[model samples]
Target: MPLMRPRMATARLTPSRRPHPVTAAGAKPAAASTMGGTLRALSLLAVLAAAILATGCSTAQIEQLKHSRTGIASGERVVILARQHHSTHEAELDFVECVGNALSRGANGLEIASHSDFVNGLYPWFEPAIAPLNPEELPALLARPGVAERLAETGVRYVVWMDGMTERVDGGGSLSCAAGPGGAGCFGLAWWETDARYEAAVWDLKHVDQAGLISADVTGRSVIPAVIVPLPFISRPQANACRGLAQQLQEFLVVEDQLTR
Candidate 1:
């Protein structure tokens, strides 16, 4: 009886509470939402970077060009010529014409002689000799007797030599061509990329030295798909090159203020 009086009641133990599975599941969705937002932000940044790159020139060389508030003189005459070589193609001639026309319009009254006029009209006899002159031989050609005199007679103060070509840099996918009662046609899924590269050497005939060198390069890609019907897209790399070269020539020949005026 005495020992039983000292017996004390034992306290009941309770289990600790834990997080609900539903609550854990809810937290997962919130984490996923945050991750989704981060991914979207990253994607947006990539698109913006690509857009900036696409709008501007892929490759440009303008450091050799002179930056002046007062550009070429109004009465000074300029001629655009194509460097002759085995690699020289007809596109260079077109580029020359494009640059000449652009300079004529933007050079603030400077005389821009057409390539044909210089070749066909001024010194037709020397065309064969001068047409083959490379960049290195330009100085020697200018020093030759009657060469400088002829250019002077025509009033050509600056001679710009354009040389380069546009070529398919990369191509992939499959293309197949076939002929039948319908007609000859090509069908496939294909894509190709091209690069247009050219350099302009501006020679100061009056000073007998190179004034500047302007190089421009443009790259473009196109895709063609055919499933019974064919659809082809034009990359127009040469056209892009022409526009870029002409614009650069314009900027080189004219000052910013002159263009606005």
Candidate 2:
């Protein structure tokens, strides 16, 4: 028999195996869990957006009454002063300044006298002890010696007396914090509402009459949500009240057509 050639050993391979589904019966629970987590994240984001929208906002209701027609000439001056005679709290200095600056701005704005300077210039007369509380008391104050002459010399034509203050009228929320050996932190949410009430009486020194009366009531909501540090969402009720009152006041003094009766 012919010599048989040495047979070489060789490894054999079957056909390639197809990829199996990753989320099969054994992994289906994990896939569902991942989807659930994503949905929860989206819902939390929406709630936060809504909360931000609801906080740090202010609203105002303004009213005006015309006692008599009023207008100011270029040479005339108006001064804003806070009334101390009111039984309730008096208007804040910043609020008074805000209104005065607003009225003195713009091309159509009126000439505004310095609050401190005007009060000081008419010192002793406009002292807190004897300052006129309303337009009716103006005549008596003006009748004092040298008062009339001093006012005329300064070209002071109008007087705006403001009274009121801001208060925290309502709030409802709870917050708690705790400390541990591992760490110290604060966690919780709180909210509060503020109300700002302000009113101004306009008097005409030249005519010795009440020109107009304007008042503003503003309410605002603020919230603070904390995880580790408190995040305050402050609403500016006083500032909003001042801006609204000033805009209405400027229009009130311009003497357009007739006036709001």
Estimate the TM-score of every prediction: 0.59, 0.76
lDDT of 1 by residue, 1-261 (tens): 111111121221111112234633453354345445767445433433332333232332222244222256656788887766544463466667776776677425457876777776546433645453534566777676777677767777777877788788887889798888855645456777778778777777665666566676666665554433334544565775676666766666565343221
Consecutive 10-residue window with the lowest summed lDDT within model 1: 1-10
Clashing pairs in 2: none
As a whole number from 0 to 100, the lDDT of residue 170 in candidate 1 is 84
Q: Can you give the lDDT of residue 153 in candidate 1?
A: 73
Q: Give the number of the best model, judged by lDDT.
A: 2
* Residue pairs with backbone overlap in model 1: none
Off by over 4 Å in 1: 1-70, 87-91, 106-110, 120-145, 176-187, 256-261
* Top TM-score prediction, candidate number: 2
Cα deviation in Å at residue 95, candidate 1?
2.7
- The count of residue-pair clashes in candidate 1 stands at 0
